[model samples]
Target: MSKKPNIIVAEDEEYNFALIRIIFEKEGMNILWAKNGEEAIEILNKNETIDLILMDIKMPVMNGLDATRIIKKINNNIPVIALTAYALPEDRAICMDAGCDEFITKPINRADLIKTAYKWLDQ
Candidate 1:
Protein backbone atom coordinates (compact mmCIF):
# COMPACT_ATOMS: atom_id res chain seq x y z
CA MET A 1 0.00 0.00 0.00
CA SER A 2 1.08 3.56 -0.65
CA LYS A 3 2.07 5.67 2.32
CA LYS A 4 -0.19 8.44 3.55
CA PRO A 5 0.70 11.92 2.34
CA ASN A 6 2.33 14.05 5.02
CA ILE A 7 1.04 17.63 5.25
CA ILE A 8 2.13 20.51 7.46
CA VAL A 9 -0.42 23.15 8.41
CA ALA A 10 1.27 26.41 9.40
CA GLU A 11 -1.42 28.29 11.22
CA ASP A 12 -1.39 30.30 14.45
CA GLU A 13 -5.09 29.95 15.20
CA GLU A 14 -5.88 26.80 17.15
CA TYR A 15 -9.42 26.56 15.84
CA ASN A 16 -8.29 26.85 12.26
CA PHE A 17 -5.58 24.28 12.65
CA ALA A 18 -7.94 21.88 14.39
CA LEU A 19 -10.54 22.26 11.68
CA ILE A 20 -7.98 21.52 9.01
CA ARG A 21 -6.61 18.58 10.94
CA ILE A 22 -10.04 17.04 11.28
CA ILE A 23 -10.80 17.49 7.63
CA PHE A 24 -7.55 15.99 6.34
CA GLU A 25 -7.47 13.20 8.87
CA LYS A 26 -10.86 11.99 7.67
CA GLU A 27 -9.40 11.75 4.19
CA GLY A 28 -6.70 9.37 5.41
CA MET A 29 -3.80 11.78 5.21
CA ASN A 30 -1.14 12.48 7.82
CA ILE A 31 -1.32 15.97 9.25
CA LEU A 32 1.29 17.97 11.16
CA TRP A 33 0.63 21.26 12.91
CA ALA A 34 2.95 24.25 13.18
CA LYS A 35 1.80 27.33 15.03
CA ASN A 36 4.07 29.69 13.15
CA GLY A 37 6.28 29.97 10.13
CA GLU A 38 9.42 29.37 12.20
CA GLU A 39 7.96 26.23 13.67
CA ALA A 40 6.83 25.13 10.23
CA ILE A 41 10.32 25.53 8.90
CA GLU A 42 11.75 23.66 11.83
CA ILE A 43 9.28 20.83 11.23
CA LEU A 44 10.20 20.68 7.57
CA ASN A 45 13.90 20.59 8.40
CA LYS A 46 13.41 17.68 10.76
CA ASN A 47 10.90 15.79 8.57
CA GLU A 48 12.13 15.70 5.02
CA THR A 49 9.29 13.50 3.77
CA ILE A 50 6.57 16.16 4.00
CA ASP A 51 4.53 16.18 0.80
CA LEU A 52 2.70 19.46 1.18
CA ILE A 53 2.20 22.58 3.31
CA LEU A 54 -0.99 24.52 4.05
CA MET A 55 0.40 27.91 5.00
CA ASP A 56 -1.65 30.67 6.57
CA ILE A 57 -0.82 34.18 5.38
CA LYS A 58 -0.93 36.12 8.65
CA MET A 59 0.82 33.86 11.12
CA PRO A 60 2.80 35.31 14.04
CA VAL A 61 6.59 35.07 14.52
CA MET A 62 6.92 34.61 10.78
CA ASN A 63 4.37 35.12 8.03
CA GLY A 64 3.50 32.46 5.45
CA LEU A 65 5.09 34.40 2.62
CA ASP A 66 8.45 34.46 4.35
CA ALA A 67 8.09 30.84 5.30
CA THR A 68 7.18 29.80 1.77
CA ARG A 69 10.30 31.51 0.45
CA ILE A 70 12.52 29.71 2.89
CA ILE A 71 10.71 26.43 2.34
CA LYS A 72 11.25 26.64 -1.39
CA LYS A 73 14.92 27.06 -0.76
CA ILE A 74 14.90 23.98 1.44
CA ASN A 75 12.97 21.82 -1.04
CA ASN A 76 11.36 23.32 -4.10
CA ASN A 77 9.56 20.15 -5.09
CA ILE A 78 7.24 20.00 -2.11
CA PRO A 79 4.05 21.92 -2.90
CA VAL A 80 2.97 24.79 -0.66
CA ILE A 81 -0.63 25.99 -0.69
CA ALA A 82 -1.35 29.49 0.63
CA LEU A 83 -4.40 29.81 2.87
CA THR A 84 -5.66 33.28 3.68
CA ALA A 85 -8.79 35.16 4.68
CA TYR A 86 -7.98 37.83 2.16
CA ALA A 87 -9.29 37.17 -1.35
CA LEU A 88 -7.77 40.16 -3.06
CA PRO A 89 -5.94 39.74 -6.34
CA GLU A 90 -2.82 41.20 -4.80
CA ASP A 91 -2.98 38.58 -2.09
CA ARG A 92 -2.96 35.76 -4.62
CA ALA A 93 -0.17 37.42 -6.56
CA ILE A 94 1.87 37.82 -3.40
CA CYS A 95 1.41 34.17 -2.54
CA MET A 96 2.46 33.08 -6.00
CA ASP A 97 5.49 35.34 -5.81
CA ALA A 98 6.42 33.73 -2.52
CA GLY A 99 6.49 30.32 -4.24
CA CYS A 100 3.11 28.85 -3.28
CA ASP A 101 1.90 26.21 -5.72
CA GLU A 102 -1.78 26.97 -5.04
CA PHE A 103 -4.06 29.37 -3.09
CA ILE A 104 -7.15 28.75 -0.98
CA THR A 105 -9.24 31.28 0.89
CA LYS A 106 -10.34 31.02 4.51
CA PRO A 107 -13.59 29.39 5.68
CA ILE A 108 -12.37 26.49 3.67
CA ASN A 109 -14.79 24.26 1.78
CA ARG A 110 -14.36 20.55 2.36
CA ALA A 111 -14.81 19.55 -1.26
CA ASP A 112 -12.53 22.25 -2.58
CA LEU A 113 -9.88 21.52 -0.01
CA ILE A 114 -9.93 17.81 -0.79
CA LYS A 115 -9.91 18.39 -4.51
CA THR A 116 -6.94 20.74 -4.29
CA ALA A 117 -5.05 18.45 -1.98
CA TYR A 118 -5.60 15.48 -4.23
CA LYS A 119 -4.57 17.50 -7.25
CA TRP A 120 -1.27 18.44 -5.65
CA LEU A 121 -0.68 15.00 -4.24
CA ASP A 122 -1.57 13.38 -7.58
CA GLN A 123 -3.98 11.05 -5.87
Candidate 2:
Protein backbone atom coordinates (compact mmCIF):
# COMPACT_ATOMS: atom_id res chain seq x y z
CA MET A 1 0.00 0.00 0.00
CA SER A 2 1.30 3.41 -0.86
CA LYS A 3 0.76 6.14 1.70
CA LYS A 4 -1.21 4.07 4.19
CA PRO A 5 -3.62 6.01 6.32
CA ASN A 6 -2.88 6.53 10.01
CA ILE A 7 -5.61 5.64 12.48
CA ILE A 8 -5.73 6.27 16.22
CA VAL A 9 -7.85 3.82 18.16
CA ALA A 10 -8.54 4.80 21.77
CA GLU A 11 -10.14 1.90 23.57
CA ASP A 12 -9.43 0.91 27.19
CA GLU A 13 -10.56 -2.68 26.99
CA GLU A 14 -7.63 -4.88 26.08
CA TYR A 15 -9.61 -7.49 24.18
CA ASN A 16 -11.64 -4.89 22.37
CA PHE A 17 -8.57 -2.91 21.44
CA ALA A 18 -6.93 -6.04 20.12
CA LEU A 19 -9.96 -6.89 18.07
CA ILE A 20 -9.97 -3.46 16.50
CA ARG A 21 -6.26 -3.67 15.87
CA ILE A 22 -6.63 -7.01 14.15
CA ILE A 23 -9.20 -5.62 11.81
CA PHE A 24 -7.07 -2.63 10.84
CA GLU A 25 -4.02 -4.82 10.56
CA LYS A 26 -5.72 -6.98 8.01
CA GLU A 27 -6.32 -3.86 5.92
CA GLY A 28 -2.59 -3.08 6.10
CA MET A 29 -3.47 0.34 7.41
CA ASN A 30 -0.86 1.98 9.60
CA ILE A 31 -2.45 2.36 13.02
CA LEU A 32 -1.62 3.69 16.47
CA TRP A 33 -3.35 2.17 19.48
CA ALA A 34 -4.22 3.95 22.72
CA LYS A 35 -5.66 2.26 25.79
CA ASN A 36 -7.42 5.31 27.20
CA GLY A 37 -8.42 8.87 26.39
CA GLU A 38 -5.43 10.42 28.11
CA GLU A 39 -3.09 8.22 26.14
CA ALA A 40 -4.90 9.27 23.02
CA ILE A 41 -4.27 12.88 23.89
CA GLU A 42 -0.62 12.14 24.44
CA ILE A 43 -0.37 10.48 21.06
CA LEU A 44 -2.01 13.43 19.41
CA ASN A 45 0.24 15.85 21.21
CA LYS A 46 3.23 13.84 20.11
CA ASN A 47 2.32 14.81 16.53
CA GLU A 48 1.53 11.54 14.85
CA THR A 49 0.20 11.69 11.32
CA ILE A 50 -3.21 10.36 12.22
CA ASP A 51 -5.58 10.54 9.29
CA LEU A 52 -8.51 9.63 11.50
CA ILE A 53 -9.49 8.51 14.99
CA LEU A 54 -11.76 5.68 16.19
CA MET A 55 -12.61 6.64 19.74
CA ASP A 56 -14.35 4.71 22.50
CA ILE A 57 -16.59 6.93 24.61
CA LYS A 58 -15.88 5.65 28.15
CA MET A 59 -12.27 5.51 29.24
CA PRO A 60 -10.17 5.67 32.43
CA VAL A 61 -8.51 9.09 32.45
CA MET A 62 -10.51 11.08 29.96
CA ASN A 63 -13.60 9.96 28.13
CA GLY A 64 -13.72 9.87 24.35
CA LEU A 65 -16.05 12.84 24.21
CA ASP A 66 -13.64 15.07 26.12
CA ALA A 67 -10.68 13.80 24.15
CA THR A 68 -12.47 14.40 20.88
CA ARG A 69 -13.37 17.88 21.98
CA ILE A 70 -9.80 18.67 22.89
CA ILE A 71 -8.37 17.17 19.76
CA LYS A 72 -10.82 19.06 17.61
CA LYS A 73 -10.08 22.26 19.43
CA ILE A 74 -6.47 21.81 18.51
CA ASN A 75 -7.27 20.66 14.96
CA ASN A 76 -10.78 20.10 13.75
CA ASN A 77 -9.81 18.69 10.40
CA ILE A 78 -8.89 15.28 11.73
CA PRO A 79 -11.97 13.13 11.39
CA VAL A 80 -13.03 11.28 14.54
CA ILE A 81 -15.49 8.39 14.44
CA ALA A 82 -17.01 7.13 17.69
CA LEU A 83 -16.54 3.41 17.81
CA THR A 84 -18.24 2.35 21.02
CA ALA A 85 -20.70 -0.22 22.35
CA TYR A 86 -23.14 2.42 23.48
CA ALA A 87 -26.00 2.16 21.01
CA LEU A 88 -28.21 4.62 22.83
CA PRO A 89 -29.34 7.72 21.01
CA GLU A 90 -27.79 9.89 23.70
CA ASP A 91 -24.49 8.14 23.28
CA ARG A 92 -24.29 9.13 19.64
CA ALA A 93 -25.52 12.58 20.53
CA ILE A 94 -22.76 13.10 23.05
CA CYS A 95 -20.11 12.07 20.58
CA MET A 96 -21.55 14.27 17.83
CA ASP A 97 -21.97 17.14 20.25
CA ALA A 98 -18.34 16.76 21.18
CA GLY A 99 -17.45 17.28 17.51
CA CYS A 100 -17.08 13.74 16.25
CA ASP A 101 -17.12 13.77 12.47
CA GLU A 102 -19.17 10.56 12.40
CA PHE A 103 -19.88 7.42 14.44
CA ILE A 104 -20.31 3.69 14.04
CA THR A 105 -22.10 1.34 16.41
CA LYS A 106 -19.98 -1.11 18.35
CA PRO A 107 -19.19 -4.70 17.39
CA ILE A 108 -17.76 -2.89 14.39
CA ASN A 109 -17.88 -4.83 11.15
CA ARG A 110 -14.43 -5.23 9.60
CA ALA A 111 -15.78 -4.18 6.20
CA ASP A 112 -17.57 -1.20 7.67
CA LEU A 113 -14.47 -0.15 9.52
CA ILE A 114 -12.47 -0.15 6.33
CA LYS A 115 -15.23 1.62 4.46
CA THR A 116 -15.64 4.32 7.08
CA ALA A 117 -11.90 4.90 7.25
CA TYR A 118 -11.68 5.15 3.50
CA LYS A 119 -14.58 7.56 3.31
CA TRP A 120 -13.11 9.98 5.80
CA LEU A 121 -9.51 9.46 4.85
CA ASP A 122 -10.38 10.89 1.48
CA GLN A 123 -11.86 13.95 3.10
Query: What TM-score goes with each of the models?
Result: 0.97, 0.92
Q: Tens-digit lDDT track for model 1 on 2-118?
A: 889999999999999889999999989999999999999999999969998999989999999999999999999999999999999998999999999999998988898888998
What RMSD value applies to candidate 1? 1.1
TM-score of structure candidate 2: 0.92
- How well does model 2 score by local distance difference test? 0.86
Model 2 shows how many backbone clashes?
0
Across 3-117, the per-residue lDDT of candidate 2 in tens digits comes to 8888889998988888888988888787788988888889888866778899998888889998999999888889999987888898788889999988898787878888888
- Off-target runs (Cα >4 Å) in candidate 2 are none
**Candidate 2 Cα deviation (angstroms), residue 58:** 1.0
Q: List clashing residue pairs in candidate 2.
A: none
Winning model by TM-score? 1
